[model samples]
Target: MIDATHDTNGTRYKLFSFMTHDVFGHGQYVKHALMENEGSECLTDAVTSFKYVNPTWEKVRVIIVEKGFGDISLL
Candidate 1:
């Protein structure tokens, strides 16, 4: 999926997207965060269970993920 500025002719996102919160809301309508090595490590580590993403997955909303999946593909 492509996230950028200036809407072009056409674009689309995946069935499920991987995005993080921009606490400060620095720029654009959508402020998505990139994956970090620390997060990747956390995802892989057995002791680490989950990370709460307040922006995308609001406090009331809930989704399950595998131990190391930053993205989801049930199909």
Candidate 2:
């Protein structure tokens, strides 16, 4: 499973199991977006820019989890 977390600092992503290989394309897309906006004010801004540039690439699925202090589990 692919997991991700976002906070004030930035977005953190991790992939569990070998199935991660299938997600390289998605990762590349995100990387390219970030690279295009080299000096983005925040991660949210970068993502917004990406959507504006590529309107066709919509419907990204993300499982947002709320974790308390010291909690380290995928939701």
For all candidates, what are the clash counts? Answer: 0, 0
Give per-residue CA lDDT, model 1, range 15-43, as digits (tens): 22333334574422222332222233422
Q: Which candidate gets the maximum TM-score versus the true structure?
A: 2
Query: What lDDT tens digits, residue by residue, belong to model 2 across residues 1-75?
Result: 222333323443321211112345542223232222223244345445556765654455553323431223311
Q: What is the C-alpha local distance difference test score of each model?
A: 0.31, 0.34
RMSD of each: 11.2, 9.9
TM-score of 1: 0.20
Q: Which stretches of candidate 2 lie over 4 Å from their true place?
A: 1-41, 62-75
Cα displacement (Å) at residue 21, model 2: 9.9
Model 1 worst lDDT run, 10 consecutive residues: 42-51
Query: TM-scores of the models, in the given order?
Result: 0.20, 0.29
Candidate 2 structure lDDT: 0.34
Top-lDDT candidate index:
2
